[model samples]
Target chain A: MNQRLKLFWAGVRAEFPLLIGVFPFGLIYGALALSSGLSATAAQMMSSIVFAGSSQFVTAQLVHGAAPGLVIVLTIAVVNLRHMLYSASVAPYVRNLSMRWKALLSYFLTDEAYAATIIHYEEEELTPASHWFFLGAGLSLWFTWQVSTAFGIFLGTSIPESWPLDFALPLTFIAMVVPVLKDRPVIAAALSAGLVALLAFSLPYKLGLILAALTGIIVGMLLEGKESPKEAL
Target chain B: MNIWLVMLLGGLITFGMRLSFIYLLGRFEVPETMRRALRFVPPAVLSAIVFPEVLMPSGKFDFGLDNHRFLAGIVAVLAAWWTKNTLLTILAGMAALLILQLVL
Candidate 1:
């Protein structure tokens, strides 16, 4: 087999584990979007359109509440603001790829894709086919998201309304974040951000979340600065 | 303000952010402060989301045994910390919530 395809397969394999967490999320998003008053068309298209998980869920909830379109758009943007960090981190690795590759990969840069791809990029030295690996991960996820969303939309009708399935979303986040809490700074970042989120929960437009995240980042950075130069270099 | 319009604008902005640094390429380097801060992004952001979901399971704050999600979330946190397995953590947490709701 070709080296590029081999690397692509490797990327897909590496991302397979993360997909376990995402599958339920796509289903939940699909179910919630329909319940949130979105048309079946809008609900399914969002998997391709916004193409984000958490933000899509938030958009559905806001739509259910009759939030203005601009507010939903702005909230989606803020919720996804973290993607810029992922972009900057992976930018150098894929800098040499063509514009077509960059644009296509960028569309699939969801939290799951970024988590898998970034780890692959950082751990494995630059290889000629590394970008293909990224493509494999991103494309596989895109396909799963679309399919799972459609399945959820179809099943939303029979799924009992009493089920607290929405809680699954945060459970996935728990799975994602917990393994990474290896040190003081990361732990502090999580704890501080969580506290602030609760304290500022009443903030309009969910500004509290953005504020809490920023504060936690600053706290983690400052604490890391004081303790060790180990992180900076 | 239409759904399609909202979707389009949201899609464009999301794509823009994902493309921002990649497009800058050789021209811009992420600053040291921002670079350091970025390390905290996942933990900070995820925690910000998780805390509210657990504490505000009903879309409002409730800190008691009756808050099934909050209680189950603690189970998930412990499961995630101990097992460090995504599937296990989610299973443990969800099981706890479902059982709690049934028993309560």
Candidate 2:
């Protein structure tokens, strides 16, 4: 076998552990997206279109709640803002690739892909086959995400609508966000956003969510920036 | 406000973010403040959604024990905080919700 293919398969094998985690989320995302009032086509298309796991889930929840298009798009951007860092980190190694390769690789750069690629890059950073390794890691994840989403959608269609499955959406979000709320600013941010969301619930076109999210971000940022001596203690 | 349009725009923006630094490549450095702000986006955004759903289930404040989702959400929070397990936290929250809704 060729060295690039050998490296690519090694990258794919490395992704197996991470795949165990993402596969279920993809399934639940498909199930939730459907219950959130999206058509089957839209639900499946989203697996490819947005391609970011958390942001796709958030988009489904917002769409289910009848949020306007603009707000949903804005939320997607915010949730995915972290990807910029990944792009920067991976750029130098793949800098010699063509524009087409850059664009394709950028689209494939999910959390799992970046995780696998970065570790490989640290060791084999400038190897000619490094991009192939990235492609292997990314393509494996993309395949799994799509297949799992389709399976979830199939299962979603059979479940009765009266079962209150939609509750899973927020429940899933709680599970994800709660684990990350250890820091003081993050805790404050969560509290502030939750409160603001309630207060601004009646705002037109669901603009309140955007308002609440912004307020939380700004508050968290300000608190972090103005760390007092007492906080240091 | 079409769903397809929203997705198209969202996808493009996501692609842009993922491509931004890579394309710019040593030309512009991300500011320290911006980096710090990015860390808060997930908790802030997710909380904004989770809070309204649980606390305002009917689009009005409901703080009583009868509010199953609110109670269940708290359970999930504890499960997540303690275990840091995604599947376990979800199962705990769902179980709590099911039991609460039936009892209340």
Candidate 3:
């Protein structure tokens, strides 16, 4: 096989495990989006347009609640702000690439793609082939997401309304956030955010979520700063 | 106010964020504090959302045994912590919630 194919397959192999985790999420998103009253086209388009999983889930929730368009748009912006970090992390590695290459890769920079691609770039330290690795990982995820979402939309129409699958959204989040609680700052962040969210739940347009998230972020940053002054600099 | 417009703008904002640092890499530097803060963004934001959903299912708080979401959320947290498996945690929580709702 050619070098490009080799790099692509290597990327695929590294991302396979993550893809397993992501498949269920895509399916759930599709099903929940439908249950939340989105048309099939809207549900499918969301997978491509927004492309981020958690934000897409939150968007479906806000849309279902009949939130103003601006509010939902703002929420999506805040939720996806972390991507800027990923962009920075990978920027130096791909600096030499053309603007078109940068644009294409940016479009594919979801969590799974970033995880696999960054690890590949760090490990291989390859000057250009890392781009191929990113392409492979990203295209694989993009393909899987589209197909799984379509399947979910089709399956969602058949499932009974009594199933209560919407609860899966929060459950999915619990699963995600719980494992990441590895240390004091992270735990503090989670606990503080949870408490504030409870207190602020009555806020309109889900502004409470934004406030709660900011509070947690600040608390975590402060705690972390004390431990690592270099990080504070 | 239209749903489509919301999605379109959301998509645009999302794309912009993803493009932000990459577009400005040579021209700017991300502050160290901002980078550290970004580290906490995921855990903080996710928990902020999760807590309200599990603890306050309706308009009010419910922390007692009758709160199936809270109980199931605890189960999911334990599963995630022990297994480090997202799928397993979700499945366990969903199953637990289903059972709790049926029983109570």
Candidate 4:
């Protein structure tokens, strides 16, 4: 097989384990979005349109309560702002590619894709085949997301309303976030964000979330700056 | 706004953010301070979102034993910190929440 195919398959292999976990979450999002008052079409489209898992779950929750569309949109943007970091991390590896390739890869970028591709990029130096690995990981996630969303929509119609599955969404976020609190800056950021969120919970349109997140980010940055000017410089 | 419109705009913004640094690389370098700041983005943003969900389930702050989500979330944090396993953390948290809800 060609080098690109080899890298693509390698990417797929690396992502396969992660997908097992993600598949169920996607299905849950689908069912929850529908039960939360989104039409089947809307729920399905959201899987592709927003593509970020946690944000989608949050959007579904807010929509269920009839929150304004603007709030949902802003929440989605904030939740996904971390993608910029991933973009920067991976940018150097793929910088040689044409604009078209960058555009295609950017569209496929998701947490899973970034996780798998970044590992590969770091482990194996950049090569023409490296982009193919990202393509494979991203496309797999994209395809699985769409299919799982559809399944969730179908399953949502049948699952009883009292299952309390909505809790899983937050649980998933905890799973993702808690493991990352490896150092003081990360811990401080999380604590500060959580405190701000509680204090600002009364804010309208879920603006508290944005404020809380920004506050946390700023806090974390400042703390890191204080700790290590060498690292910062 | 329609759901699709919201999604389209959200998707566009998301794509723009992701593309921004990728497109700008070499033309400019990310500031060192910002690079350090970026490391905190995931923890900060995710915790900001998660805290309110567990502590303020009904859009108001809740504390004490009645806050099952808060308790479960703590369980999740411990499990995640100890194990460093995403799936395990999620399962433990969900299970804790379910049991807590049942008991209370």
Candidate 5:
């Protein structure tokens, strides 16, 4: 077939593995959100409206605790701050696309979509068809998320608590990150970020994640700066 | 402070963050240092998320033998490092957690 279709399918294939992990998580979110006193309509709409998995889960938990709306909204923004880093990481690759394409892809910029798309983008130089791959990955995930949410809403209380489905999310991340840890800076970044996350995890509103990520990025950059001159010499 | 209002505002804020750099970087040039740092974003951010989720599964730090997730996470790490395969790594971790839970 054509290049666009080929690249699109490649993107979908790359994202397929993550969808398996995301589906169960979405199911749990839907069930939890409904049980957390949100109306069924609101719970279902949240899968589309907020669309960020972790934040949606947090919102559900907060709703259960009868948190004020202002607190939930603020929590969402704080939790999703990491998406800014993702936006920066991906911006250069999609810069040449139109505003319309950028807007559409931005809606699909959840963590899983970004994970798959960034890995693909890093493998090659950008081409006219590159955004098509991102669209493919993002779109497939969007579809999976909505469908899984509906299933969760339908079968609200039946999901077994015994399944360790949530563990799949971290395992998927490990699989992604370990393959890319090829150098001292990258390894240091991963280790330092992991350590800092454990240390600062009690920070409210999930700020610890953003702080840990920034610390790791700075660590990686500093190490790279020092190593660059040695390699140049 | 309606729930609908919360969702609307939250959605808009999330959309804005997702759109921020994708829109700005096209218009303005990023510095060389910032560009280099972006390469580390994935490893750093993903590790940050993963470490907390696996280590602090219940919002409290758990490092004892009772923490099956931590043990399973180490298994998954080895699986990911050795195989670099996503599906395999997830399977190994899930299996480890389930088995550990059942036995211990």
Candidate 6:
């Protein structure tokens, strides 16, 4: 295989585990969107148009409750603020790519794709073919999301409530994050973020997630800053 | 306000945020502190999501023994820590949650 294809498949392989988790998530989103009074076409289109998991779910709920258009739009913006952090995190590695490539990859920048691609980049850094891996991961996730959402729309509320399939997402995240906690600062960041998420769980529009992430990052940075002075003792 | 219009606006905003840094960083330098903080983004953000999902399965905190998701999450954490494998961790977590739900 050529280098690009090889890298692409490598990305697909790395992202396979997360796809298993996201597939069920997309299905639930589709089912929920329909039940929330969205038309079949609108619910399916949201998967492609909005292309976000959590925010799409929130939008469906608000629509069900008859929220105004401006309010839904505002809520979506808040819910998706985390993507900016994701954009920044992956920016340096893809800076050399063309504007078209950047736009394409940015469109694919879901949590699963970011996790898979970042781990690959941290290990392998930038290569001529690294962007292909990002493309592969992103495309595969996009395909899975669209298909699963369609299935969900077809089989609304039929999926058993007892299955606990959504737990796979958190498990996937735990797998991704735990391996990265290589130092005290990183550990502190994860713990702080987790604690804050719980404490701020009631926040509207999922703002707690952004707040918790910022708190964790600050805690990590502060501890790392103190590390040099502490080592001199 | 049509639903399609709402979706279009929301989608544009989302795509803009996703593109913002990637597009700007190519034309300008990212600050040193921002570069360093980026390293923590994965752990911090992923934990922020994972913690809430497991701890508040029903959108409320439940740390008691009967909170099977919390217990299952602990098992998944241990599995991930030990194996460092994504698939195994998910399988272990699902299994733990199933067994707990069945038993309790």
**Which predicted model would earn the best TM-score?**
3
Q: Can you list the residue pairs that collide in candidate 4?
A: none
DockQ-best of 2 and 5: 2
True contacts kept of each: 0.82, 0.74, 0.77, 0.77, 0.81, 0.79
**Stretch of 10 with least lDDT, candidate 1 chain B:** B28-37
- Candidate 5 lDDT by residue in tens digits, A167-210: 66677678778988999999999999999999998877566777
Candidate lDDT scores, in order, read 0.87, 0.84, 0.86, 0.85, 0.85, 0.85
Please write out the lDDT profile of model 6 over residues B17-96, one tens digit for every residue: 89989999857776767656776776887788789788888888889999999999999999999988766887898899
Q: Give me the candidate number with maximum DockQ.
A: 3
Query: Which sections of candidate 5 miss by over 4 Å?
Result: A1-25, A28-40, A54-98, A110-136, A162-176, A202-207, A229-233, B1-6, B56-61, B83-87
* Residue B79 lDDT, candidate 4, scale 0-100: 87
Query: For candidate 5, what is the DockQ-based docking class?
Result: medium
How far residue A153's Cα lies from its native spot in candidate 6, in Å, is 3.5
lDDT of 4 by residue, A124-154 (tens): 8777778999999999989988998899999
True contacts kept of 3: 0.77
Give each model's clash number. Answer: 0, 0, 0, 0, 0, 0
TM-score of chain B of 3: 0.93
lDDT for residue A105 in candidate 4, whole number 0-100? 94
DockQ of each: 0.70, 0.64, 0.75, 0.73, 0.57, 0.54
Sorted by lDDT, highest first, which candidate order results? 1, 3, 4, 6, 5, 2
* Per-model TM against the reference: 0.91, 0.88, 0.96, 0.95, 0.73, 0.72
DockQ of candidate 3 (2 decimals)? 0.75
Better of 2 and 4 by DockQ: 4
Which has the greatest lDDT? 1
Q: Write the per-residue lDDT of candidate 1 for residues B3-81, one digit (tens) a residue.
A: 9999999999999999998988799778787778778987888899899889987778899989999899999999998
DockQ-based CAPRI category assigned to the predicted complex of candidate 4: medium
Number of clashes found in candidate 2: 0
